[model samples]
Target: EPQGKIDTGAEYEAPRNEIEQKLVQIWEDVLDIDNIGINDDFFSLGGDSIKSIQVISRAKAKGYYFEVKDIFNNSNIKALSKCIKKNALTISQDEVVGEVELTPIQKWFFERNFEEKQHWNQSVMLFSKDGFEKEAFEKAFEAIIIHHDALRMVYKNENGEIHQINRGTSEKLYDLNVYEGLSEKEITEKCDEIQGSINLEEGPLVKLSLFKTHKGDHLLIAIHHLVIDGVSWRILFEDLSKAYEMAKDGEDIILQDKTTSFKEWAVEQKKYADSYNMRKQLEYWSYIDKFDVRKLPKDKEVAVARIKDLRSVGFNLTKEETEKLLKHVNKAYNTEIEDVLLTALGLTISKWTGEKNILVNLESHGREEIVKNVDITRTIGWFTSQYPIVLSSSNEELGMMIKNTKDSLRRIPNKGIGYGIIKYLSKDKMEFKLKPEICFNYLGQF
Candidate 1:
């Protein structure tokens, strides 16, 4: 197979008639496919580990011992069939297996009061090379809602407490409340206008618009940051591109990669948050007064600017300029992208305040240890956590400062307490001097 091609779609040799027929029936049932070809790859057809387990458990109930890895290695039905030789599985077909384990994260916050209607807001403009393709794009839009369950997830109360319910994406998506007949420019303006106010729901919130050009070329996707944090976007975008490509190629979509869920992460966070280490970590930020700083230089900015036109700004470096700088950052300090970016950000804030008594809030993806193969870039989850680090600079020994960061970060307790403590202390209403706060939150690009 040439890079993802299912070439050997018919290369299986069934050892026993009864076992072979049973395997084929089980595969068809789990995969929801009609045809029974031995060489057909399960993964290529959208089967995943979770689904593999389901098949394995079912086979085990019928007295078969097909390991999960065995399924993965022998993805094609033919290969799996040959591997299952000399083993005629008995089928009881009564007991069920491979049930989803309720994640630890889900257990903790299950008692919290979760909102029902619109947890967060979002908007997006759909652009296309073909202007008349707006309708087609809307059809394409439905596919996204169908693919990701996190998008359809809503808050539900099982017993007096609340929890996230994964309303599996089947079809009510076609009924998505889409406001049609919008010009490309008008759509762009609408999205840019609303981007600032979009607090976005707890999970992955979505918005879409059609930006058809005179000649025709546009972008089409908008989602809230609450659930789909920094890393999830990359995963979402990649899945979107591939799914769309496969659809265009007329292939069946069998998206099967959600081994972990957001609820599990949330439950785990609560667990770790309640630990002894967490309590000590909390001490570091209790009444630390992180925002005590000098004023800004420009002095002309909103805590958040609510403008009609949303413009994009970024600092771009040339290859030579970037390489030379990277060489210094790499050879001198063995620095990371985040360390470099944060150090620069600290320096900017320091220069603006004209004070070295700098206390700035830093952020890192807290989902690193929460789940296995989470692909933080795809599934919707509150995976971002804040870390407040003080980068003191009385003198301009910048190199020394960068070199010592690895140790500074390591010496701190696990992030669970550092952030949890800050949130708890900051919640003190007595410290509140303003209604609509002046807390500094610079939500940046992933």
Candidate 2:
């Protein structure tokens, strides 16, 4: 960890107050660690962006409210607790049900107009050794759909413009299927069928299939990409696990109070796009668009690369190496994991392609604090931002290259969120188009 941050295996101090004790408890639960100290660093304990949101959500459920940024600013329990306060704004308790505006990311998705858009989805297959009760699982899933309003979202093309609406609780939430004694190939085929079954125009964007086998049960969940993202999956998984346990135990399932709804966030994003601050970012984005970076030479070119054309090679680092990379190395450079990884990537590209100016399409989680008093830390929806960045790898020295790359990334305003705002939501029509061949997204440790 850092200079004075408490190590997980070392002696540590305890929480000093009730708030600190509560925060410690939440941290322990969310981080899946035992006896987390008041001064322990969250990231050091495998706490990431997703876990941070879980902490905030669970804390909110306990009537302690704070912004997501507060966690980053004050990572430890004692420090973070000092920043916590009673929620000032009156958050709506009623179910969020109405027409929802498309976020910049959603607008970007529609602009692509991809073929077979309905098949564009995110899915997960979870296994339970003990298996699940059908009725209990249904109840849990129903509660999840009702709690997370975005899962009920449906789209329609009206006058060539796509419109999104949040269906009421009375509507069907998900499609569920049960299978018994299915072979592996059969299970794979069933998953494929369900994956392709997601409908965007009609209702029911979420699908579930439970397979019963001699060993265990496999549950497959497929959700339309428009309604969910990486962060949303974490929230969904946690809620499903909790709600299922409660239902299995024959207890009333009561989930945490919803954070700012996705609908509210959509509206707030539109307003922020038109704000003076958003307009100020036009120059920065324009500069990025104008940056001249030659594309890397490819071994062979294809007219169009489909999913089948893609190939991936995986590698692993030793546990000791991973420890140094995640904890120790950052202390020397005063940087994050992304900075070091990008620095290495930029250097390698420069050496191989003889290109000092490297262009990259960067992706961020997009839950930035752009608008004041707007929080979507616990809200479930697709909130990913994609924008172009140019990394200057002119420096030959290792130290200089790392510093330069770190600076280049840090220079991005609001994690490059404004680029999408200006491109999709701004009134002024500017022809700002730049596409990089390579996209870099560092999804932190799961």
Candidate 3:
């Protein structure tokens, strides 16, 4: 074991081992940043707690299961690797439920009336043994298809009935290649070639492209986030890794997947009424929006829905300055950094709207929290939710106002209304129509 073990509970430090390099690669890929040190703390290095769940959840893909506490305990890459055991996640069976019908969320997507396309524009991550055995990788993939329902989903009809994601048998792998040292432009071309493999309206719901680099003793693997959501991806990684590990050992892989399929969930959700909570939310929203802002923000005025311009702005504070700011904020109010950010935006809206109390529709992801103990790593569906947050602010002390606004927002049910389904559900109903014209998203994944 690499001897740099610190109480991940105490100080931050780097892990010293070959394993850290893999951790660094995974973190860099997931965080989309580079130059991470072995001792660098994920959150301290700019990873939020929400993203932490995603990172640790995916530990399975790499042949390990990182308890949320593990990352915190081994805050640095070196420490994390010291604790990881080879064949840790090796299992005998798949780690997912039986393939079911389209989930309630998937059904909601088909009703959105968006242009239907056959190919699912999703990202995927695949891993194999360090030795780069092409023959074994092929066999592993074949086993995945045989054991799991790879291309099965359900869509909802106008009549509120559900149907399979596509009406056909899933296709088998016709080709597989793992390349390295390709230029960015070359990688783009490779992506185009991989896109040809997806059949959104037919066999497959998403595309999978593999890119591998021979790093002497190990391999660098990167997965995309298209066909599967964060949760499902982790399940896929863990199960896939276990499968490959078992194959290497000449043992039958065991999975901890779900007993029923996503399809089963969809067909069952319909027996429940969508009105209970959703309708109550609508009533609360309608009641709150009676008094509108002086003028809607510029974002809502456009007749067409285009992506809001995403401008990333960063700033730094000196150690002393940081301490002082945190102290003052803490003294004035009890809140977190997230609350502060929301408050500032709310106040900014107030400045523009002249409306002291403003409601902004915020988008949140709802990937987990379903089927407790069930591994949903590869089950992709529209797992996001939206909620109305009323930011009450004043001309003075905008920061304080923001902090308070967020505190109030923390109380609402968090299952955010992701656009994929929310858009379709409220398509024709004015009641389900959005309340606030202005919106904000702190997409942890993006």
Candidate 4:
């Protein structure tokens, strides 16, 4: 659907050298596509931020090393292979087990001091026709806890001051709770129960529950939000599947080589927060802070809103419409899906509220290449950044709106990473004046 110079009907060129051949194989395995040519583009073949991390990790396992940016800059195998280095990056073999500094997101969480901190988590539900083996699942999770340093994180409250530490992996990491003959309703309740059982102070912030139902087995995994984000889930699930299969087959459970650790990223982030570059963005954020945000009219006002009080209305676009939105329409304006979606949202909000200026709280993956020589493509942690952006819906024309929204997003510094740094980690913290009621996030294709 996307217009490009590469001819799909023509004969494709195969990998020429060992590096290119290895890269092609890795890309095929990660993307789950067959016969990826050296000239093929990564994004055209369904490559995204998450899949790029997978490719990087798989390549590193094979003794090849390259940054995530290299993949973006050199999308094709031939060009990427040239940038790949034979010498591996200096990743410490020892487990990162010690006191770890809280990142900007973690600091933001602590600042909130939610009512039930332990119950705040990110979770997933997986179902399989054939039930999983408890032994294999435990072994797989144990391997994961040891490899991903952040999974073993624990918090300690010392005289009103909170600190985090990565506990040693020798202790029991996971316990498989197996329930027999649970109905769908009971399984849902059990998931909620497990979600509330995560202990932040002690250790093992991750919980796993297995429910055996009439149809199939259900697996529920709940991890504290302090250590995991959307991108981290992809890395976790991929490693879990691979490790579980190896354990089931009675083979040694060996995952891919570790990338930069979460601890390293946190340290680098602290340094960057105090750097001159981060300080320069203060004026921009201050300008954004001055935007006048109007509160949306609510049907019923309540003192407090909780999960139980929330309601959602679902909508779906037809398959043909989705195709145009994702691919075909982008060609006309040279825009991304976010630009178009945000334009529509801004226009709708402007019509509803009768306001031209629309303020939105935007969330980004937050794994920007801000620090030099620090690669977190495969690292797992709560690397999400929240920042505010004001979209002007003064122009009603669709084309002009798309162009304006795209330009507005382009003006953000490092995908809004510096906002969190300046707010939570800076020496002189200033409370922001404008708080956007609406939040928007676009999770790219999984």
Candidate 5:
């Protein structure tokens, strides 16, 4: 079998047909590229799941209805053009669906909202060498909020059930906090003071504060975790940088194409829950539920205190050792680093608790290949999929344990996304709750 060839510098022809021309334009707009060729591959040009959703959303706006699967299946502009279902439906580029159902992760957050609200916030502080362009940066920032619908969501409770409503744009701007001539301690205190003050119920989840100091400008952006995740931040930063540069140069604020709205995803998820594959996976989970696992040690059986004080502890191996474990050792055992890590965890926990079998909750990115043409590459929201996995440390040999862990994970249908689908969206309304005490997640690389 012959694999595809790589020719980065190869020249390609322009789009021929009218459909191809329009598709090329969409590709250029979504990928932030200029003059995209008809033959250019979508994935090769930085089209991810989120971006794929944007492409389809933009296409729908242009009266060319298509799904994410079409983009994946077609791959190129010419092929995608032929695949799109031409329609006369006209939807505004800025108009998004209102009153959407809460995603699984969002529901999880709401269930635990009795505790500290500020802990559910995701924030970053950026120190740019040169001062930011006041007008340009403001416009760029506004464009970002307008482009992503999730950034404009506010949660509301209807009949005791919480739902997210998409409110268009906000009049909020990046207010500058003057910390000039102030001591370092004062600046630190001011930042902390502002960080602790954010209303979760506010429509606009994203807020910015600029600190003008003697050295340089420090831009602090804080967004609620319900609207943005780790991957969403990367897309936001990239778009911000590009938008800022364009606006500074007196160019039009043209962001990449819009992805599928989060509201649409919620509707699709409901439909997918009733699917045959999802039903089959639910059966598998039911079968696995029969086995009982040991729980971790805790002070109180029925805890009454809210989890207020939380902290993170990080550990990293040497670069060489990390690479050897991730690449060489994984390849030799025909397994992944996650499997090895999980097996090691099982061994370590068994030693501590004296339990051969244990159940732990594993968090997945939740962007599985379920709906054929739906893409969420650029769609930002809490899309975490959490499921329970039973790990056994009964095996004495390390190799056998690793193999067992890998096999166990491989048995999960659609990366455990089906669990969330069935639990939240299924019409059966069966109460299936499996809460594992310990949670494990591996973020590959940021």
Candidate 6:
């Protein structure tokens, strides 16, 4: 046991109604906050996707369940309580433990070395002008490593197949390398140098370092993509805030129990892949595979060597313009932005290459309703699904093209996650087919 403990006593207005009371209890337990107001925003109070799952999981245990989207859309306790009342759901088992199979995304990653120059390690550097306790941050990080299973994961090749092995509880925390009085340029160069040096086999695929400067300490957190994604970052940061607060006061680091272990999700996914429902989904993809659409043409042909290195260019629209455009388009065509974007792309490519039809790879969140009663709102891993879509602009009219794209996207089974099932998981001997040239994924607003 640690020598010192932090006091978590605080005061706030009490819950007024049954729904608010129950929600308050749940938030207090999950967020480790002593007193929570009904009007408090979830994200403002450090609630994240993973914790959101915990909220849903706990609410179901109390005979109320709501959609994860509801939580995202209605974040405050008052709004969430109303949502629960309007949409009460029966409790279902949402957790699984023990060794798990590799998900399709993981299999795809391991099949080939996606990283040619550096390991698939991502890092974020944060600097604060006000100083903070280094020891407290270290303890907070230690708690996070124990709370999240993926952080302590390692891979093993068993009989020519790779499997993710969760270490359960880890007693070790990542050592934060500290540098004092370093120049900003030197610190950046040092961070870049360290970013390329992660060893996947050695395990504990996350690294952190702190650089002390006149302003404060610059913290850099690096993690491998195999076990984490964009949503996971939100959860990790939220937990870190709570943990840091606790550790600063020498309090015991406590986090809400994890809902579903990643291993359990993988096993459930594999079972779903082999089920009759998945076979039906494959039929949908089979129909799509019959079309041999033209690929998007490039300005110039590049050497094979240059294919490994890719560059990106981006443009942005004002918030008002973007929201209005989406609203007008959806209202006019009864479609989402994805349909409008894909239709525009198809039209642009058709005009550029003089091709009536084209093929593009589309990526999705992959958290489709494949398995029953399993909520992964809090579960984190790379749940990205990649599939090919055939787009045609034979009519040459923008409205017709939009309708064609909307109808085509609507026809996809399971939002295209089924594509991976047919191509990768199906036991039937599969044929080698050409893949889409241009990949397009609309990542929801940052």
Candidate 5 lDDT tens digits, 184-299: 68767877777666655554566677777668788778787888886677678768999999999999888766666778788788888888888778778886677676568866
Encode model 1's per-residue lDDT on 1-446: one tens digit a residue.
22333233345444346666777678777656555556666654445444564576456545555555577578766567656633542322221122122332333233232342243343334344544344444545566565554555545445664445555454243222333556757765656654433322233346554444465655546554434544456455545666655566666654434434554444454454455655565455543444455544554666554433457567889967654443334434644344555566667666766777555555554544322332222345445555556655555577776666544555555533346333432233123111111122333222
Cα RMSD to native, each candidate? 13.1, 2.7, 9.1, 3.1, 6.8, 9.0
Per-model TM values vs. the true structure: 0.56, 0.93, 0.58, 0.90, 0.76, 0.77
lDDT of candidate 3 over 1-446, digit per residue (tens): 23433122334334355567668777777666556667665654545545556665456566655554466567667667767755443223433333345433454454444442333345543344454565655556556544544334323243645445432334442245566777657766777667555444234343344555553212222222223454455455656677777777787766544333444434433332254545455554555446555447564454554334556678877967654443334334544445666777876777766778777777654543333234333343444455566777876665556556755765554344423233344433443443566677664444
- lDDT by candidate, in order shown: 0.49, 0.84, 0.51, 0.83, 0.72, 0.71
| Residue pairs in collision within model 6 | 6-250, 6-251
The list of candidate 2 runs beyond 4 A from truth reads 1-11, 44-47
C-alpha displacement of 276 in model 3, angstroms?
A: 5.2
Q: Candidate 6, residues 242-344: lDDT per residue as tens digits? A: 8999999889998654646677677777777778988777666777788877555667776463534777788988967764554344556656667888988
**TM-score for predicted model 2 compared with the true structure:** 0.93
Q: What's the number of clashes in each of the models?
A: 24, 0, 50, 0, 13, 2
Per-residue error for 327 in candidate 1, Å, reads 6.2
Residue-level lDDT of model 2, residues 45-121, one tens digit each, is: 76655577778878887888887778878877878988989955567868888789888889888888877789999
Residues forming the 10-long window of minimal summed lDDT in candidate 3: 217-226
